[model samples]
Target chain A: MILRPQLQDIKIIGQYSGRVILGLGLLMLIPLLVAVCLGEHAAALDFVIAASFCLSAGYVLILICFTHKEPTWKHGMVIVSLSWLLAMFFGAVPLYLSRHWGGYLDACFDAMSGFATTGLTLVQDLDHLSFAHNMWRHLTMYIGGQGIMIVAITFLVRGAGSALPVYVGEARDEKVLPNVVQTARFIWLVSLVYLLVGTLALSVTAFSSGVPAVKSFFHGLWVAMAAWDTGGFAPQSQNILYYHNFTFELITISLMLLGSLNFRLHYALWAGKRKEIFRNIETVSFFISIMLLFGLTAFGLASAGSYPGVSSLFRKGFYQVISAHTGTGYMTIHPLQFVGEWRALSLMGVILCMAMGAGACSTAGGIKILRIGVIFRALLEDIKRTMLPRSAVVMDKIHHIKDIVLGEKLLRQVALITLAYIFLYLLGTLAGIALGYPLKLALFESVSAGANVGLSCGITRPSMPAALKITYIFQMWAGRLEFVSVFALLGTIIALVRGK
Target chain B: MIGKNFVKIWLVFLGISTEIMMTVFIMLCALGISWLISGGWR
Candidate 1:
C-alpha cells in the first residue's frame, strides 16, 4: 500500500503510479462486459473507446511519475480528492461517448450524482434513456453507496494509517472494532449478505405478486442498492410509487429500516452478544425518533383527508416516513399531491426526520445518529442541572464500551454542527422561495434536496432553474458528508494552492 | 466534523478501484485495436 502523508509530500507516488495505472485498466472491463453481454454493440464500442483514452493517460502518469512507498496526510488527501475528481473525469467518458450530455461538467455532475448516490438527475428524458446508460447509472449508485473508498480499503490495502482516516472520510464511524480493515471487512460482509437476502426476498415477493420475473429482479437490484446504502435511486422513472403495491411498499420499508440501523448493531448481533445489540444510544434514539416522527407524519396525513382509502394513506404515509427518516429519499407519493393539501406541520415532521439522517457508518446522509445522541444527552444534563439547586455543578458523561468520555467539547461540536446544518437548510429554502417558486413547495424541495432526502415537491425536475440545480447539488454534496468533509476538502485545496 | 485526513485516505483507497477501472479500460481498447489490426472482424 502506498501511503501519502501530507499532500505535497506524497511518497511512492511514482512507485504505485504503475499499479494504479494497471488497476484502472482492469476495472474498465465490468461495464464493457455488461454492454457486450447485453447485446448493446454501440454501448460496447463507446465504452471501449473511452476506456482506451483513460487507460493510456493513467499509464503515462504511473510509468513516468514517482510513486513512493509512503504518502503523507496532505498527499493522501490530495490523491483521494484528485482521485474522485479524476473518476469524474474518466467516468464522464462513458456518458459523453454515449452522446447524452451537451457538456462535460453536466456529465461530471451526472456521474457525481450517481457515484455520490445523490439520485438527483440531469438526464433530460428518463423514458428514453439507453439501457446501458441506465445500467451504468444504477451500478454507480451501488458502487458509490458501498463506497468506492471502503472498497479500496477492503480490496487493495491493509494498513491502519491508510484505512482508518479514509474509512471515516467515507462517512463511517467504526464501532464494532478498532482496526479499519477488520471493520471494512465486517461492513462489506454484512452488506453483501443483506444484499443477497434483500434481493431474493424482494424478487420473490414482486414476482409472486404479478410483476414479470425480469422486472422484479431489476427492481430488487436497484431497491437493494438504495436500501442497503440508503441511496434513493429508483429503478423506474416514477420512483417507488411505480409499484404502488402494498406488498412492494412493505418490503421496501423493511429494507430501509434494516439499512438505517447502525452497523455496530449488526456486528453485535453477529458476535452473539444479544445484550450489546440494543444498548447503543444511537439505535435507541433512532427507533424512538422513528416512532415519534412517523406517528406524527401519519397523524398529519390521516387528518389531511388526503387519502380517501385507509390503504392508500398507509401506502403513502409509511413509505414517506421511512424514506425521510432513513434519508433514502425514495418517495411513494408525489410532492404535487402533498402540496397545500398537507399542512406545514407534516412537512416539518418529514424534514426533521431527514435532517436526523441514518445511523453512523451507514450510507444514509444528514447529521447522523451518534451526534444526535450526544446532543440529546447534553440537553438532558442541562435540564437536570437547571432542576437542581443553584449551587450544584454537574459533570456530564457519555459512555460507550471503550471508555466514558466526559467533556462539553464533543457535545458542543455536535450541537453547533447540527445548528449549522439547519441554517444551511434554511438558506437553500429561502433561495428557492426567492426565485419565484411558491412558498411551501420551494421550502419542501430545498429541504428535501439539501437533506439528501430524494423526495421533492413540484419544482425539482430536469429543467429546473439552473441556479436551483446548483443549490441542490451543493446541498447534496454538503449533506452527504455532513458539511465537515466538504469544508475539509475546501481547506485542503486552499492550503495546497497557497501554503505551498 | 468531516476529518480531512480521514476522507483523503478514503479517496486514495477508492482511487485504487478507479485505478483498476482505468486499467481495465485500457485492456478493452487494446483488444479492440488488436482486433482491428488483426484484420478488423471478418
Candidate 2:
C-alpha cells in the first residue's frame, strides 16, 4: 500500500527545514561582513535584505509548523530534499537583487549550481561583481560542499535518528564517527584545516606571481575553498588560467585530490592508519582510472596535434583530465579551447572521467569511485563464479576503512545508481542537442552539468534556451543527490496526488 | 584540541604527501607513454 504523508508529518518536516534555513541565514553573515568591510554598500544592502528575508521566512515556518513530535525517517529525507530547494530559492535573493543575472530563474540556477558545488555559472559580468557577491558565491561552495544539512546537524539538530536520515539524504552514506553529529564535526574539522593550509600556500604563490598582496590573499582563499571543496566557481571568469602560475596550478591540483578523497578514508588516515590509503579499493580504483584516462587524453592531444609540445600537453591536457576526474572544474584552458582545439577523442576522455567522478561521500559528483570499484569487483566475482566448480564457493571483498564482502545486494545498489547517473546524463544531452548544439558538444556539456563538473565547452551562457537551462539545473540537482532523495521527493508528490 | 591531535596532524601531512607523490609518479608515466606513442625523440 502507498502510504501518504499526513499534515502532521508535513509540519514536522517544515519545522526541521526551518531550522536549516535559519542556519543558512546565519551563514550569510560572513559575506555581509565582507561587504561592510569592503565598503560595497549596495551589495551590503542586498545581503542585509536577503538575510533578513531568510530569517523571517524561516521564523515564520517554524512558528507555523511548531511540533513537539520527533521527525520520522521519511520526514527527515523529505525535509532535506525540500530544504535544498528552499535554500536555492532563498540563496538567490542577493544575486537577483544585484541585477547581474538575466532573471530570477537564472539566479536560482546559479544558486543551485553553487549549492550543489557544480560550478556551472549563469552570472553575467562576474569579473565586475562586487566583493560581497563574489564572497557569497564561493561561500555557497563551502557551505554546499559540507552539505547544508551537515551545518544544521553540527549546530542545530540534536536527535540522532533525525540527523542520520538527513545525512544519508545528502548522499553521504558513511559515518566517520559513531555519532552522526561528531561525524559532521569531523568533516568540518578536516575541511577547516585544509582551508587554512591551502589558502596560505596559494596566497604566497599568488603574491609571488605579482598579484597585489590583499587581492592575492582573497583570490587565494576563494580558489582554495573552491578547489578543496571540489566546487569550481572562480572569482573571475578566466578561472585558474587567470593566475598563469605553475605553482598555483600544482597547489590547486593537490587540493582537488584531497577534496575528492572519501571522508571515511580521511578519518582512517588521520587516526594513523597510513596503510589504509594504499589498501582502500576506492583509492586504487581512482589511481588506475586517472592514469588510464590521462594516457588516453594525452594520446588524443598528440595525435590531433592540438598541443604544440610536451609541456602544453602536460599542463593543459593532463591538468584538465585530472580536474574532470576529481570533479573539480577549475580549468586553466579557455572554454573555446575545448570546442575548437581539443579533439573528439580527448573530449570523450574527459566526459568519461567526469561521468565516473570522485569518491563516494566526498564533495564531488557523478557515479563515484566507490560504485565503480564495487561494479568492477562484482564483475570479477561473476567471472570467478563462472570458472569455479558448481559446489565451490567464491567470495569477493574490498577494503574501505575495513574489509567489506561484495554481495548481491551491494552490486545491485551500485549498478542501479550507475544506471540512474547515465540516464540523467543522456536526458541533458538530448535537451542540449534539441537546442541545436552539435552532438559532441551537447554530450560534453551535458556530462559536465550532470556530473557536477563545471568544465564547459562554450554552450552554457545567458543566451541558451531557458528549457535547456532548467534541464541542466534538474540534472545538477538529481546528480548531486545521486537520485534517491530526488526520487523520494517525486514519490511523495505522487502519493499525495494519487493515493487512495 | 589542535595540540592534542599531534599524531593525527602528522598523519594528515603524510597522507597529503603520499597523494602528491602518487600523482607526480602517474603523470610522469602517462607523459612517457604518450611521448613514445607519438614518436619519441622526433
| DockQ (Cα-based) for each candidate | 0.01, 0.45
Residue A48, model 2: Cα distance from true site in angstroms: 0.7
Evaluated at residue A335, the lDDT of candidate 2 is 97
lDDT of 2 by residue, A413-490 (tens): 898999999999999999988989999999999999999999999999998899999999899888888888888888
Model 1, residue A288: displacement in angstroms? Answer: 1.7
As a whole number from 0 to 100, the lDDT of residue A223 in candidate 1 is 80
Clash number for every model? 42, 0
Off by over 4 Å in 1: A1-28, A99-105, A390-395, A399-403, B1-42
lDDT of 1: 0.66
lDDT: worst 10-residue window of model 2 chain A: A71-80
- DockQ-based class of model 2: acceptable
TM-score of each: 0.82, 0.97
